[model samples]
Structure formats: structure tokens, C-alpha cells
Target: MGENKNIILALVLSGIILFGYQYFIAGPRIEAQRQYEALQAEQAAIEGTENAGVIEQDDAPSLPLAVSVDPQTDQSSSGNYTYADAKTIAINNAELSGSISLGGARFDNLFLANHNVELNGEEKVQLLVPANEDNGYFVRFGWTAVDASISADDLPKATTIWTSSDTELTPQSPVLLRWTNAAGIEFLIKIELDEQFMFTVTQTVNNTSGNPIQVRPYGFIDRKQEPVTDGLFVLHEGPIGVFDDNLEEQTYEDLRDADGGKFESTTSVGGWMGITDKYWMTVLIPDQAKQLAVSNLSYKASGGYRASYLEKAASVPAGGSFETQTQLYAGAKIVETIDNYQDEFGIKLFDRSIDWGWLYFLTKPFFAGIHFLFGLTGNFGVAILLFTVVVKLVLFPLANKSYVSMSHMKDAQPKMKALQERYKDDRQKLQQEMMAFYKKEKINPLAGCLPILIQMPIFFALYKVLYVTIEMRHQPFFGWIQDLSVADPVTPLNLFGLIPFDPPAVIAIGIWPILMGVTMWLQQKLNPQTNMDPTQQKIMAFLPIIFTFIMARFSAGLVIYWTWNNLLSITQQWYIMRKESARRAAKAANKA
Candidate 1:
């Protein structure tokens, strides 16, 4: 009875964890997403009405470019703007394709060449879009005048149309954009692209106006609106940065309500700041040797947010030129690519761009192990299976001790029943006797809970890996399992689509979840269950069903891992039980 209570407590705790996540986190997110979509549609309709006519280049609102000593107070232009069909320098490479808008010299239109919006679709994933589009996001670099003599208009503004040196920008060929102001200050942005997603933007200012000038180079990633996030508390999606080698993450809501709608970091020497989505990110990496201040800001008037950085002002002597380089990383958050960029460019904690959660210690290495297996198998699903086997082997010793203790408890059930019957009238006596019985049998009543407790962190770490990593996006397993990063699509509710009717998400139970429930039930049966209260027994019997429903909304890859882990556990426990029973029978025979 005591052992049964311990098992029941463990099961209840597990249920609470899953239920709390769904109710407190996932449920609200789903509703918020629905509301956000409706709001977006309404905004689109209003924009469509206001922007009915063909908008000229001159009519487009210029993005405000101002540098403040306190980045929190930096302001930007407001009002609606259209994507002007202006001149652009074509950008083509093996990993990315887009056009660099010569106007404002912004990286406004970019797409990941290897990733698609849909599993079977030809349309590529757009990482950055034109400033006028819905959820418009882009990166731009400019010089901020620090001297009172240099006015903002005398520097390059977003309206400035720079002349491009090259017709096309590629990995092999870099482009140089040149612009001059009335003050005889010529601003040049030499853009270079790597084979992957890193773009090197070197800003050079040649001051021909004789008088000494002071200016600070700055870069910013602008998002026209708050994006719809995954809504999972486990995954962060919004403004993130690594300042002073420490990672900081803030949500859109937090940034909006911050003091003056801004969050600033202490002056740090070389860090990266960016806005990140679930799979993609746009980070501004300044020169590693420069002292800079990073900030996350939200503009209520423009209904947009920005992550920006301002470097220490550089003094350009009367005839001397000032040059500073900042790198922009815009693409899918592949772990290897990000790590490589971190190592190659000496970007501080660049891999932190992918929200690895608080369990970075475990989550990253777990991903690395599965990633290694993926390299050999060419299939992420197979890699997950192999990784599970490795995890099981590594934890076998501890689990074996737990299972052996459980087997002993099961073997002593008959004696335990007699003890329970004798003390049924006295609750205190029953408790005292049970403890004595457990001691005599060398059994730990709470031994069964150890395995369940141990699995919780591992489950969370794997879930984080599947939920946040781009490598798992659109990855296929076997038949009908095309995308492992989402819930199983083939549901039995509509006879597996044989009836041509799609069931709602509430009843959308898949085959894998059912298999997991079955394995969980079988594993539970192998545990000691005799002399337990009838209500507790019933509760134990229903846990598998409860978990099946809870996990139905989780990613299929996670469901697969859970199911595979359960099956392995069941096999190990059953073997241990059989061995324990055989040993008990042989000892009795020898005693006879």
C-alpha cells in the first residue's frame, strides 16, 4: 500500500507538470495566436484601404535616423509607408537570395535559399522583408553625428539613395554603396557576403569639409510590428542580445512597457544584439574591439520595435577618414552555422541566439549528440531513436537499481497484504508495520519514484531542442510523418483521413500517442500494485490516458522520443521482474 502511494504521488506530480504547462502556458498562447491573426487581418484591410493608390517614392515616409547619448531615447519616424519599387542591388549566393535596397542602404528583402515556407512548397522562407510589408523587418547601418556642428540632415538618412558600385552582390563580389551630403561628407558602405548568412558592412566616412567632426557608427534591426510568437514560455522570441559576454532576452511586451519603451545595456566591448523568431534571427555584430552600447526599443507611434547598437564616438581629424565594421547575421538559426560564426568572427555567445532555455548545459549537448547521429543517418527521426538508446544505456545502472527494488516490492506483495489486513483497524499500526516490512524485505517504497523524477529534466531538455531548433523544422520521419517539429497530422478521428473529414484539434489523437499510452500502461502494470486503495488504483490506471491527451499537442519528434523511451523502460523492468521472481522461486526450492 505504501509503495502504491509513492507510485501514485510520482504519477500525480508528472501529470501536474504537463497540465500546468498546457494550462498556464500553451493554452493562452493558442488563444492569443488566434486573436493576433484576426487583428493582423483587420490591420491589413485598413492598410489596404489607406494605401489604395500607387504610392510614389517621394510620398513614402522616411525612417528616422537619430543617435542619442542614451539609446533609450532614440526616436524613429512614424506613419504608414509603402514598399517603393526603387532601385536595388541584386544579392545572390548559395545559401541566400535577396536584394539590398539602395535606398537607405538597407538589407530589407532577403530569403533563405535552402528553407521553404512549406514542406513541399517552392516558396523560400523570407527572413527579412521590405519596410512597408506587414511585420516589416530589416537591418540598416548609418553614422550618428556626435558633434553639435553636424546636423542629422547633413549625414545619411534613410531617404538617402546611395550609388552601388556593383550591379549584383554575391559571395565572390562585394558591393560598395556611396552617398555624399551637403557638408562634403562622403559616406561609403562596403558590403561583403560570406558563403552562409554573415554580411560584413564596413561604414567609412571621408570628411572633406575640413573642420574636425565626431560621429558614432550605429546599426539597427527594425521590426514594423510585434510578431506572433510561439507562445511557449520555454521558448523566447523577441529582442535578445549578448552584452559583456552575458545573454539577455526580453519579450515584446516587456520592451513596450520598459522605461521610455527602451532597455539599454551597460557599455560593453563588442557584443551582438538582434530580434529573433522561432527559427530565424537578424543579429548586428559590431567590431570585437570596439566599445559599444546595445539597446532594445519599442516605438508606440510607429507600432514597431528595434534592436540597435551605438559605438563610442570616433574623432575624425580635419582630413582623416573614419571607418568601422559591423556584421549582420540574417538567416535560419542552424546550430553549426551559428557556432562557426561565433568561433570565426569571435562573436560573444553567438550561439545563444537560438533560445536554448535555462538548461543550456544539458540542452546544447543533447542537441549535439542527436545532431551527430543525424550526420550518420541522414534522418533526424533515426537520429532521435539512436540518441534515446544512448541515453538509456548511460542511465542503465541507476535505473537497474530502481527496477530491482521495485521487483523486490512486487515479490513481497503477498506478505504485505497480510500485514495490511492485520492492521486495517489501526492506521498508525499499518504505517509502522509497513515501514518494518519494507526494512525486512530490503525494499524502498519510494524507489519507483526515482525513475520518473529523473526523466522530467531529460524530457524538458529534449522538448526544448525540438521546439526551438531550426534543424528539426520540417524534418520527415516515416510514412505520413512529414514534419516532426509539429504534432502528428494523421489522426484517427477521421479514420486517418479515409472519410475526407478533418477533425478539430481537441480530438486529434494520433497513432504515435496511442502507442505511447499502451507502452505506459504496460510499464505501470509491471510495478507493484497489490493491496492499494481502489481509488488510487483507478487513478493509476488513468494516467496513461491523461498523458496521451496531453502529449497529443506536443511535437511528433518529442512524442516519438517519449514512446521509444517508455518501450525501452518497459523491457528493462520486465526483465528485472522476471529475474527477481526466478531467483525467489529457486531460493524457496533450495530452502525446501
Candidate 2:
């Protein structure tokens, strides 16, 4: 009894210590960091920093001309030039429709034709925007001078106006742009679009005026601002790419902390790199088996980030043409689309653009199984329900034994209490007697914890899949559950959308979370762990409400899966308990 009290005291102290550290230490540190970052952002904004919204890559063969298109901006580092109104060239494909700006030959204005901005809404999902606009995000393909003597004006700068041969760019029809430099170099850029979001850009230069010129082909995607992410802990929503056959992620904060706000990799091959949002990504993939310099750069001036890669320098002799091809992926990060592109284009680890995290091996298979079930059931919610049933069936034998042990322990509870009272003054003897009693009944005190230990990994893996996989995004379940990847939108405080007022997050319990809590409470009631102390019993009773509140902000699909699993557990435990009770009753009758 004394030893048990010590154990209970230790557990309670541990919980208190953990809570105290989080509330008193970690919480304040996080808030202070947030405030500092906000202050820095505000100060930078007041100072009108140059390229404040631009994200760039460093260590490229040649640096892109840093030209500011903002008229009010006075930064002279970016060449001095008058900006012109950009003429738009339309691009139409099966999956998307957008336009390219002629002013700088930038692929700007793209929208996912299939994905809606809102659930069951008609607005198309916009992915890319012009560099000068808000959140100035767009992909630009151009050349940089390998020769230091080559004038910046001789190259196609951000404000360069090029003439396009075609009015529209389509998957079947590519658009070509031509520009001439007084230094006898004629630059040709061919932009080709696939049915999806992949853009093949071929940059060619012809030395027409007889002098040999050297230049390196370069491409970059620029986002003037960071994306608004759902959450920061689980999924990566910033600079992510494949380099040298390995996956790499650099968050916005990581970039800002890097020396000079730059990171570069020169030893990369057969891989691609780019920026990724929650459900969309824009990556630059150079030709495989080719040597390329890649970099992720952050700039305070533009208040954004950019991923750029440069290919080997090409020398165009008099009457000679030099050309290079690179691919641009800008659209939804659909799992199938990304994987297919990975196999088709040989983009190494392209599928990793999704934030699979460390437990990818487990999370991926779970997602695949659930995806297969989704196909069969046609609804993710129903598929989740079926998946729970399958998992329970697989664990039936282990759970059966565990329940039996728990039942035996519950049956011995009265005897345990009597021993405790008799040995109230003898702590060591009470423990010895309790052990003997457990041995006589063949009950394992720790058996009740086994099921939870077994289920923890599966629970986390399923949560990861539901949170990170784009397949779960906008996936519908039954009524009122529109997007499984997002928290249930209808809150109980608003009477499940019947009322107009939005409640505080504390009271914003969703239907699925509430159901999960109720199921948990029911399972606890059916569980035969009656030896728990009064404190433990109260904690167990409150666990349902605590878990419901904790999971209210999680993905609805995950809550549904957990709730279904709890119900199945309750069913199994209740049945087992009834059978045990009946058997005990029959034994008593026989003795009588």
C-alpha cells in the first residue's frame, strides 16, 4: 500500500511538472519569439526593404538581375528600368487555365480548374500570381550571363518585353518568345504545357552577330509571401525539394536564420526542388543526369522566398545555337499525379513533396489501404468505419485475452479491498498478499495497458495520413462532414450551423469529436479495470471530455476513425464482460 501510494504520487508529480514546464516556460518562450518576429516584420516593412517579398536561390552559375518592379521602390541594386504593362498570353489545359506575362516571359496567373477554393463551391483554386501583385508568385525562365563583361541590359531582365509567336499556349500547342540583344545574341524561349501543371521550357540562344557568347540557363519560382498554413507542427509548408537523391525541407523560419538568408546545393542530380504550400506546390525540375546548382533564398525586400536552379554554362559560337530544357510543376499536389510524374519523368523522390514526416513507412501504407477502401466504399467516412472494423477483427484474439485478464482482476476487486483494509498498517505485506492473490487468479495487472500501447502507433499514423495527404483534402463523408482533412466546420455552440454566431474555440466541439468523446466514455464504462483508485477513476471518467476538446481541432476523418474504434472496443469489452459475468453466476449456482 505504501509503495502503491509512492507510485501514484510520482505519476501525479510528473504530470504536474510537465504541465508547469509547458505553461510557465515553453509557452512564454514561444509567445516571445512570435512577438519578436512580428516586430522584425513590421520594421522591415516600414523601411521598404528591397526584394522584401522575393525568395531566391543562391550559388547558381549566374545570378538573376535583381530588378525592382515597384515604382515607389528606390533600391538601385536591381537595374534601373521603367516597368511596362505586361501583355498576357493565355494558357489552357485540361486541368488548369492561366496566362503568361510577356513583360518578363513569366508564367504567372494559374488556377486549378478542377479544385474549388471552397467546399462545394464554384470558385476555381488559384495557384500562381504575377510577381508585382500581392503575394507575387510566378515562375520565370531566363538566361544569366556566364561572362562577367556581358551587360545586364543585354540579357532579358524582369522588365524585358518579348514577342510571342502564338496567342495561346496549350498542351498540344507550345508558345515561342523571341528577344534580341544588341550584342548580337538572339534569345528564344519556348514554353510548352502538359495536360496537367507541368511546363516544359526550352531556352535557346543564337550567336547571330558572330561573337561567341556564354550564358547559363536558369529558372526560378518566386513567391512574394509565405503561405497561410493550417498548422506548423505536423506538415511542412515551405521550401521543399529533392536534391542529390534525397529529400530536403527548409521552412521559412529556417531560411531567415541561415547565414545571409541563403542555402545552396551544388552536388545535386536527377532531382527537383521548389516551394510547397499545404495542398499545392511549385517545383523546378532540371533535366535528369545533368549537373545543376540549386538554392533556396529568402529576401526581406520581397518578404517571400524563391527556389532557383542553374544548368551548365553553354557557349554559343557564331552561327551556333545553344539550348537547355527544364520542367516546371505548379498545381495541386495530388498523390497520384505527383507519383505518376515521379515514375514518368524520373524526378527522383518527387512524391516526397508531400510531407510524409518520419513515420512515412507506416503512414504511407495506412493511407494506401484507406485509399483502396475509399475507392470501394466511395465515401471516406464509410471507408474509415470499415477500416476500424478490420483493425478490430485483426486484434480480436489479443483483445479477448486482455479483456479476460481485466475481468478476472475486476472479480478479485472485493478480495483486493479486504486485503488492503486488513494490511492497512503493513505496507509491504499488503503488496505481497496482493501479488499472491493476482497469481492465484492468473491476472496480469498490466494487461489493460497492452491494447492502448498497441493502438498508439496506428492512431498517430492514421492521423498523419489524414492530416498530410492531399487525397483527404476536400474529401466528403456523411452530411455536415465536407472535408475530412479539415476540422468539422459545424460547431455545437452554433447548433451545427443552424445558428449564425461562431463560438470560441474552447466550445467549438464538432459532431465527430463529440461522437468520439461519447464512444470513449462508453468504452471506459464497459472496461473491467475496477481496481483503479478513486483519483484514477475520476481521471478516467474525465478523459472522454478532455480528448474530445483536444481532438476538436484535428482532422474530422481522424476523429471519426477514433470514435469508430472506440465503439468497436466498447462492443467487444461489453460482450466479454457479459460472458464472464454469466460464467461466474453459473459457477456460483453449481456450488449452491
- Model 1, poorest ten-residue lDDT window? 54-63
Clash count (model 1, backbone only): 0
Tens digits of lDDT, candidate 2, 476-514: 888878788888778768777788898875568888888
- Candidate 2 is scored at a TM of 0.83
The TM-score, computed over Cα atoms with residue i paired to residue i, of candidate 1 is 0.90
Total clashing pairs for each candidate: 0, 16
Off by over 4 Å in 1: 1-85, 297-301, 414-440
Output the number of the lDDT-best candidate: 1
lDDT of candidate 2?
0.76
Per-residue alpha-carbon lDDT of model 1 for 1-592, expressed as tens digits?
4544775667677766866777677778868888987987898797675653222221112223343432222222332234464478998999999998877787889999999999999999988988755566888888766657576667776666688658999989999999988878888999999999999999998988888888777888888777666676788889888777778888988887887676676467888888898998998898888877444444445567778877767888877898998899998899999999999988888888988888899999999999999999999999999999999999888888887887787778789789878998998999899899888889887777677667878889999998899898999999988999999988888889899898767568999988888998988877755565687778778889988887888899999999999999888887777888888899889999
Q: What is the lDDT of candidate 1?
A: 0.80
Work out candidate 1's RMSD over C-alphas: 3.9
